[model samples]
Structures are given as structure tokens and as C-alpha cells.
Target: MSEFRITGKAKLAGVIGHPVTHSLSPVLHNYWLARKEIDGAYVPLSVAPDVFVTAVKGLQASGFRGANVTIPHKEAAFAIADEVDPMARIAGSVNTLVFREDGTIHGSSTDGFGYIANLEADGIDVTALANRGPALLLGAGGAARSIATSLLEKGFQVIFSNRTAERADGLANELDAAWRRHFPKGDAPRLSTVAWDKWEEQLSELALVVNTTSLGMQGGPAPDWTPDLSRASSHLVVSDIVYVPQETLFLKAAKERGLTTSGGLGMLLHQARPGFKAWFGADTEVDEATAAYIRAALNKR
Candidate 1:
């Protein structure tokens, strides 16, 4: 491996969070920068909740190109942004931020873009999934919002299931309204919620099942029950957003049943591309080499 050179003129980008030291953004983005020979640098910034606004403003004022928002800062990023892209607006959160020379910030959410990109990268035909049937999305949190919205925009009916019934219902209604407000004349994707207890019963009707919750994550509680794959559609594709352990128990169960499975790291990799383009002026590729580099870095963690 060669060293990455930087000068005072190098452009700056980074990831922001309360505890950002563990972020892999620096590794992923720097790999692209080094490979493409771009004179840019990506770092990690740990900003607390109370001073998030001040820190973001300071970054913009200090000539930093942009930063990726994480955890508690996504909502704040959306609120402070001078401009919000359609994806950010619809998802009601922003993970990527671009700083303008005039001290303004642009906000966008690439979570969904990355989610679908991950599936496509794995050779899963998203269009075919949309055509086959509705996708079952587990969780009603910020990540799920972006993913559900993205699937909806792609004309895929989404069935959202969360442990809390009200939260799931609330997200479904919010997304439906957002969809109607944004694409009034277009045929809205069917959005509905299922009780947590009932999600398994609908598996047979779903072509894709995605777990966006933290359940089964390392250190988190394991999923109480695995979906009965015997009753699921033969074309079912199971995905989980928990990537640290790489393959979550949900994915392991899916694999045992011989269903297609996708891990969350791809989303993390793919989502960085848009922000890299915004800051570095070039669209980066999420190739195998880049994936391998990140994987190696993750293992070291």
C-alpha cells in the first residue's frame, strides 16, 4: 500500500457523529481518493448534539467541502441545510451534506440509493423484485424511511413492520402523504403496515424482505423469531442493515433456507459515492477492490 499525500490546497471531507472514531467512511472515501489520485482528504469529526449546528456551520465557514452526518445528527443536518434534495425531503432526514462557498449547506439522503445499489451490486434485479410483488421492510426508523421511500419511488409496494404498531402505522402514513405531495399524478406505491406478530404470515407474498432494525446486531438482542421460510415465496430475497458482524442471524437464517441474501456493508459503500461526487467532482466506483479494502479495515476493528 502507498501513502496518501496531501497539501494545504487539498479539499476536505469527513463524517460527523457523537463517536466518530470508529467510522469506516475515512477508509472508504480515502481509498477512492487515492485510487483516483484526487487531491482530497476525508476525516472523522466527533460532534456532540448540543453543538452540532455550531460545528456544521463552522465547517462550512472554514472551507470544508462537506461531511456525512450520522446517528443523532441526520435530523439536525436536515434542519440546518440551506437546501434539501428530494431524497432528503422525502426521507425526512439527511445523511450527506455539501458545503457551498457562500457558507450554505446542501442536504441529501443516500441511504435508499445505497440500499437499492447494494441489491443491484449483488446482482439482484430490483426491477424484477418490484414486478414480482411487494417488499417487506422491517423497522420504521430513519433508515427504514429512506429505504421504504426509495422502494416506493421505484414502484414497489412496501409492507412496513415494526415492533411498535403505532410507529409502523405512523411511518406508513407519513410516507404515503410525502409520496402524494411529491408525485401527485403518479401512481403511488401501495404502502401498508403489519403488526409485528403478523409479519411472518405475509412472507409468502413478499419478494424481498429487508431488516432495517438493529435487532440481531452484535451486542443487541437477537430477533425473537425467525421467519418461517417454508411458507415464504421461493423468490424471496432477505437483507439486513446490520453490517458490523457482516452476516446477521436474520441473513444466516435466510441463507440456510437457500434464499438470496444481502448484507449491509454494500449500502455503507454505495451511499458514500454520491457524497464523494459532490465533494470531489467525480463519481466513484464501489468495485471489489474498494469492498475488499473496507472489509479488511472492518476486520481490524
Candidate 2:
């Protein structure tokens, strides 16, 4: 740790995940650091699953303040954390880590808060519709788990749907939330799964549709599977966790049908927002100017 620290040099911060080359976090965060005039450098680290533990321990001991965790390793990150926030513990994932002076680690999962920030930015009223309508999620991966737990807390009825019914069912069971194999066909707004083939049929009662898969990421345009989002019966909002392309085909299809849409950028910023303040102090602000700059640069890719 002594060698890592230098007189009059920037502090170290970064993110860890497999194939982390796609991350724009360093860009987004560095802008904030500059604005705050903080003497720190943020970078992205590509740490594979097999090497994650060693890499994290090495980083902390080497004076790295903390880091953001991404896909394929959230659960494992949780296992290594000394303590976790309530949401992360319940979700069984960790997206942020803070290193204490005593070498103890504090972790938190920001996915839920990130999603909330995104939805709130779009003016979605989750509080007003508390338990009023059924929330439909499109995947059962790490991202889904965090968002689902958030939905449960907001008093919304949630339906877990995935290409694999068993996976969705498993998630629901873990959360103690009900799971359905098919989407609701009748007027009832119950939580149920919609077969991948029959997605169009279940689009009516879905108030919020969340995409947690990597469908609309860099090398893809989402799955060939498109659900009929043209239902006039309910206001369908399409939200995709993919931020790389900024706008995924899933959200684009929703807009073409005149439905509301959202992307992962909001979540990205909000998730990092808390940790930035925690590690850099409360005065640190990841302002809109910084976020806008990062978003524009990403669009060029």
C-alpha cells in the first residue's frame, strides 16, 4: 500500500467486472472528480471471475479507495463484503464497495436505487400506483434481482418473466414474491409469466416492462422476440437495462408504437452517485453536465 501512495498524486478508484472494456464508468466518474477538484483517478479493471477475489484484495491493500462491481460477479462480491446495506443483502448482490481505514469492507447494491432514479427521471409515478398495477420484468439475471426487490418494496405487484420459466420462478421464490408461468390474459392484474412466443397477448396489463438481459447491448439489437407494445388499454413503459447503445431495439420498438421508454444510463449514474459521495465526501456531485458529456461520447460508439 505504501508504494501505491505518492506525494501530491491522485487517489485511485475503479470498477471491476469481466470484459469491463465496454464500461463508460471511468469517463462518467472522472468528470465528476474534475468538477469536484478531487485528486483522484478512476479507471476500469477487467477482472475475470476466477481472479476477482485476489484482484479486489490487492486493490484495497494497494490504497484503492473502492470500486463498482458489474455482472457475473455481484453475488460473489457480496460473499467477500464485510458488511452490506439492506437492499444489497436482500438482493444477494453488491455493486459498490467502500474500504474502511481498518481494512473492513462496506458494500451496497445500487441497482434498485439506480432503477428508481431512472424511472423518476422519466416521471413515472411508482408511489401513486403502489400495488395498483402489475410490473413486468423481462429477465431474471443479476439486474433483475435488484430491480425486483425494489419493486416489491414500492408496493407494486411484480411479474417475473423470462425465456426460462424456471429461472423466473426461482427468483420469485427467493424473494418470497409470487411467480407466474404466463402473463395475465384476462382483466386481472396478477403477476404471471408470459411465454416468449405469446408475449403480444400479455402486453395489455403490463404497466412497466423492464429488460434486464444483454439483448440490446453493443453487438445486438435485442432478441428476435418482440412483444406487442401497442396496447391502448394501459400505458406501457419500456425500460431496458442496456445503456451501451443508449437506445436498444426494445425501447425503440416501444417508441415506434407510441409508448414511453427508458434506458440504463439513469441507473448507471445513480448507482455510481452514492458511492462517489461516500468515497469522495458528501460535497461531491456527479452533476448533469458530466452525465450529459459521457452520454454523448457513448453515442458515437
Over 4 Å off, model 2: 1-9, 177-192, 221-225, 232-234, 283-288
The lDDT per prediction is: 0.88, 0.76
Rate residue 149 of model 2 by lDDT. Answer: 73
For candidate 2, the TM-score is 0.84
What lDDT score goes with residue 251 in model 2? Answer: 80
For all predictions, the C-alpha RMSD in Å is: 1.9, 5.8
The global Cα lDDT (0 to 1) of model 2 is: 0.76
**lDDT tens digits, residue span 212-255, model 2:** 87776776644453556666344777788887777777788888
lDDT (0-100) at residue 171 of candidate 2? 80
Clash numbers, per candidate: 0, 3
Candidate 1: clashing residue pairs, number: 0
